[model samples]
Structure formats: structure tokens, C-alpha cells
Target: MDRLHSDPGLLVCPDFTNECYCASCVPFISATITKEQAAESLCLVWVATNDDLCIQWCHQLAEETCISAKQAQAAAAAEATHLHQVHQLEEEMAKADKQKKNRFKHTNILMCPCPDTNEEEAFVSDFVLQKIDKGHFIEFYYWTNIGLEEALFSYSTRDDEGLIPSEQDGATVWISAVASKPSKQVVPDRFLSPVDFAQAVPRVVAALKEHDWPNQWVLMLARFWVAIMTHQYWNSNDQIAQQALMIYQEEQQRAWHNAVVLGNGAWDLSIISNTVLGRLFDHVLCES
Candidate 1:
């Protein structure tokens, strides 16, 4: 045990020390590394945890997001106050759980996604990566509680040159660039099972080669979608999730972060009113 603890490669979370979780999940270190690199991966783990972890993890992620957003002027930069508010909510959640110390072991176990690496980058193409920098493609648009008509409307208007269409008719359309929001709908509720993921791999590959959609954009969306899908399955299947948690906890010091994509609820309809896409939308939907 001492020799394993001495290993430089291992990372045992403070929460998992003293036989709390385990010491074998060293491999999950790499998985956690990848999550840190990509905003989308962070978002997946953020949404998967309970409220207490969500608040704790989100603060760490928000700091990262704030740094990245400032560099790129990404939308998350403006949400500092919002992040603070979330942090404040933590006290409330913490107070609610009176037996916090006793529950820490089990709670920590469920916080992280399954340790296996289902690299989103693998599902994307080099062509897409070469064209889209991580900063630009990290965030995109998604709608909340949208009806079928709104979904169709958003998709149908994508081709119009001037009108920057809102993602939904009456509901909120979220931009994932912010730090405190959840990607509930964007990350599909239902994901492909293990068997289905294997079977669908070929089809996802074919889409990379054949789809006329903006190659890089589609690829970005696909990666996040697939990550969440696989994670969803892992979260539900006790055997895999438990194995992953055990292996990860045994070897390294663990820290949790929420990668839930947040949105700045500020709406600006004028963006569509002024842009060329807006004019194009006028021609197609209004003038036509």
C-alpha cells in the first residue's frame, strides 16, 4: 500500500483517503485530464452529480471558464456574479445534509463519470479539428423545452443567409458558452447503450465523411453528444460505474469540477435584426 501510494503517477483524492473509496482507479486520471482540457467534457460531469457536488464542482469549473472566456471574450466572462450566486447556494445544500461527513464516501463515489475514456475527439475528424479551434467550437446553441415545430423551425432556418434565428419560438434558447447552466436538452436524455454505441460507430463515421452540414460544427456537437450518451449509460449501469469509481479512488488524490455549460439569460433580439442573416431571414420568412 505504501509503495502504491509512493507511485508518482497516482492521484488519490483527499476525500478518498483512508479506505474511503479505493486506490485502483489510476487510469481514470487520464480521463479526468481530458475532461479538464475540453469544456464539453466538463459540462457532462457537472450535470451528472448531485446538488452539493454541483455547487462545489461548478465553482472550480467557473474559474476555468472565466479564464478561457476572458481570453476569447467567450460569453462566460460576464457571469461572475452568477457564479458567486451558485457558490452561495452551496451553503444551503450543505446545511440540508446534516450527516455530511458520514455520507461523504458514497457521495464522492457518484460524483465523477465512469472512468473509461470514450474520447470525443476520436469521433471527430482531423478536417474538422484543423478548421475549428477549441475556443471557437467549444460552445454553440441549444434550445430548452422546445416543441417539435420550434425544432423544425430552427433547423429549417439554418440555411437563410441573413437572419440569425433564435433556437426556439417562445422558449429560451441557450448558448453553452456560459459557466453555471446545464446542458440538459443539448446532451440528449437518452443515449445509445454499449451495444448501440458500437453499432452506431460506423454511422457516426459516415456522417463525418458525407454530411453536408458544417463539418467542424457538426463534429463538435457529435463529440459532446456521444460523451454524454456514454456517460449516461455508465451512470445508470452499477457494475461499470462502481468499478470505475473504485479504480479511480484507490490511486490518486481526486478533485471534482462541474462542467455544466451555463448560459447568460440576457436576450438580444437585435443581433438577428442587424446581421446579414437577419436580412436573409426577412427575405425568406417575411418577404417571401
Candidate 2:
């Protein structure tokens, strides 16, 4: 572990020293790395986690989002606050009976699709939104009840070292469901809409054209959709709701900044928004 993470063998113990070192462990350390530099073995997985555009945005955010370094510190502080609250809640939930817990992990996002939110039975998405935003770290735009949507804003079962990213939980886990069937029609409940799902496609294709991601787009997109689709099950508003649309737009801007830095100017905002993204959406939807 020391050799892998560049830490002291037996002299000093860093705060993140609890990571596993077994050979059977999957290379999840590279999960935090960008698609451009990760090994090819993680290619399909890299996409399953995040395609090119999102990875580029995350990397660019490390630098471009910083203005005089103080804002960067603030972002870290914000993330830390979010993580701390999530940890506290996770500890609380893990103590509960197995049938009534949730293992909120990873950094997947969704946005609002419902029109109204004040009514009690308006739509489950609004309920999820409300629940998640109520957390100390989450600043969402809806009202909530259950702690389900609060998963991301609170930060419970995420950031485990040497752990593979997926919807499944390995150890003591928590699964949740929300009802979304309106008049027997499976509509966009508390998660992203079908159109919104297609919105991220151009970003992926552009990432493939400009930078080689560590994974295949097909598997990644499939897994991504599956995760979102999970929100359609059951009825629980006390959980995590969808994320804000502004966050994704910010993601696209960061990708543009990364393209400039890497000299991959062939992929640009106008191109992705107009030609690439529109066409990519058509391509993926046609296959679906």
C-alpha cells in the first residue's frame, strides 16, 4: 500500500492510510484519475464511471475553477462539509436494521423535470429534491421527506479506498425505491428525463474524439442510464432528489477549458452543442 500510494512504509501514517493492499483488489485507486491518463484495462469501466467530457471537466475544474486559490479552498471546504455530514448519517443508518438502510455512494447527478412542487402528492421527484437539499452539505432546489435523496448532499457510503464503483453495495448496504408511475405511465419521476439522458451523449462522443477515455461509451452510457432508472422504483421523498441543471452546464464549460489546455480544440462548445451533441443523442437514442 505504501509503495502504491507513495506513502511511508512504517514511519508515518497519513490520514488516508487505511486503504487495502490485496492483489485481489480491483484497481479502484485509478478511479479518481482522469480518462486521458488511466490504463486501457479500465477503459470500459472508465466510461461506466464517467465518459471523456465529464472527466475533462473534473480535471479542468481542478485548475480552471480556481480563481486566486481561495475559491478552490472554499470548494474543498464545501466538499468536506458535505462528506462529513454524509459520514455522520451513514454511521447512523448502518446501525439500523438491514432492511431499512441505504448505501449512498459515488457522485452521480440528476436534475428536476416536474413542473410543480408545493403539493403533497405532486410528484416524487420534488419530494426527493426537498429531502436531499435539506442536508447541511446539499443545497438543492426542492422539498424532501426521507433521507434517500439526502444521500449525495450528506456523503454517507462514498470515498472508500480500493472499492469498485457501481450501484451494488459490497458490505452492509442500503437500497431505496421511489414511486414514479403516474396513471400507469412511467414518466420522469424524481430523476432525469429521457431527453436529459441524451444531453450527456455529445459530451461523451466529443470526449472520445478529443481524448481517449479509459472505457467504452456504450457500457458506460448503459450503466449510467441504469443508475438513473433506479430512481423510478417505489415511493420515498425523504431521500436524495435530482441535482441542478446549472451543475451540468458548468461541467460543459470546464470541458471547453480543458480542450484549450490540451490543444484539442477540435471539440468546442458550439460543436458539441450544435453538431456533435445533437447528432450523438440521435445516434444513442436510435440504438436504444
Candidate 3:
């Protein structure tokens, strides 16, 4: 035992020193080592005592260290990818916010149909009239609770020799109202008269109150209705008017189905009664 301790080669092996010290057979070393340290040192001791066990211990330690390194690398990579995605989402949100601010700064024109003259007329706020110039095209956006809707109009001087005969030489603006449905279908041009619009106010207000819609929402809906009314007057020969009439008929049918067959509320019924179909139905009933 003394000869083994005296040997420099044997003393260099930590596993042997740990075993001898723990057994109270050696007093050369006072400091204690951990189990892992002892096990790692066992590889060197095994090389002298048992070669097979030494090879196995060395291989196991190498594999465990390699696995730990790979796991740390994978964790670091995952954290970086997550940070990159968060940055991209923030950038997209900022860009959308900037676009929304720019769009809201412009004023829109509303066009409505006259029930007495059977013609379409454009309505612009005093502020818009002051700012708008001839030959300038204006684009306006309407918020419909569900999504954004856009309309366009261009200002031009009317010539008496042009398609529509005008008594006075004045500036005329042609406006188009485009309704963007949830299904993304573009329904262009609808009409409303001043008398109808006046009558509609109370009914729309009542319906909105009954349905518990916000007061601001009523204003938005009113603006949308006025925008649709600004197109060409109802003429069977006009292709655009005809298309608008077709879409109106389809919408009325769908509303009727929802109300009568699908058990929708009075709000849907009110919508049906307020449109052209309601007037036509009343006329038919009066004739009969």
C-alpha cells in the first residue's frame, strides 16, 4: 500500500486517491471529490486495472457531453427564430397603422337620387367644395363595422354637346359608389330620394335602437346609404343602373328569405321595406 502511494503514476490517478482516502487507508490528501469527478477519474484507473470497463466509461462520458452540447445549440437557435417572428409582426402592425391614418385624412362626396326629378345628384360638404378642383379625382373610404368600403368621383366641366344635355355651363362631377360585401362582391350604385331619406331617419333610428346598435354606427350606415344614392338615376336603358337594380333585387330576396324562412328579426324586415322593392310592392298592391 505504501509502495502504491509512493509511486507517482498511481498517485496521479484521482479515482485511486479517492478510493484510498474514503476507505481511511491514506492520509496524503484532505480535499474530497464529487461522484462525477470520481467516475471521470475512474477511466484512468480502469486503464491499469480493468481495460474493458475503462473503455465503456470513457465512451459513455463522451456521448453524454456531446448530447448536452447539441441540446444547448438547438435551444439557442429556437430562441432566435421566435424573436425574428415577433419583430416581423410588429413591423406589419406599424405599416398598417400608418396606412389607416393616411386614408382617414381625405373627405368623401355623397350622391343621392331625387325622387321628384328621377335623377342623381352629388352632395359635397362645404369643406370639400372649397378644397376640390376641376379634373381632380377623389377617393373616399367608409367603415362598415365589418370592413372598409371605397368610392371614387372625378370633377369635370359639363359641355352642352356632351351625352347629357345641360342648360347651364357648370362643373359636373361623376361619382360611383361601390359597396364591398363580406363575400368581396362589388355592387355598384344604389339610389335614395330626399323624401325617402327623411322618412328613413326615424325608421332607421328605431331599428338601430331596438337592435342595440351604437349611435356612431347609425351615422356610418347613413353615410353609406347616401354614398350609394349618388350614382346615375334609375333608367332601364342605362347598363350601370340596370346592374344596380339587379343587385338590389337579389339583396331583397336574400333579406326576405332570412326574415320569413330563416327567422330573422324585424331589423331585416325593416331593411326590405326601406328599399326599392318595398315601393314596387306597395305600387303593385295599390294597382291590384
Q: Best candidate per TM-score, number?
A: 3
Q: Write the per-residue lDDT of candidate 3 for residues 1-288, one digit (tens) a residue.
A: 111212233233445545544543233222685554555555455556545445555666677789999999999999999999899999988876876688555323223232222111222222223222221111121111111211112112212213422222376543221211112322221333233343333333333434445544455544545443443333345444434443453455345434544555424322323457445545544554
Q: TM per model?
A: 0.17, 0.17, 0.26
Q: Pick the candidate with the highest lDDT.
A: 3
Superposed Cα deviation of residue 261, candidate 2 (Å): 5.0
lDDT of 1 by residue, 64-179 (tens): 68888687764555477678788889876886575456655433222112322333322332222222322222111121123222334433454552432233336654422211
Better structure of 1 and 3 per TM-score: 3
State, as a TM-score between 0 and 1, how close model 3 is to the true structure: 0.26
lDDT of 2 by residue, 134-211 (tens): 211111122222222333333333334233222322444232222211112222222434344443333333323233
List where candidate 1 sits over 4 angstroms from the true fold.
Answer: 1-192, 229-236, 239-288
**Cα misplacement distance, residue 197 of candidate 1 (Å):** 2.9
State the C-alpha lDDT per candidate: 0.35, 0.36, 0.39
Ranking by TM-score: 3, 1, 2
Q: Tell me the deviation in Å of residue 92 in model 1.
A: 50
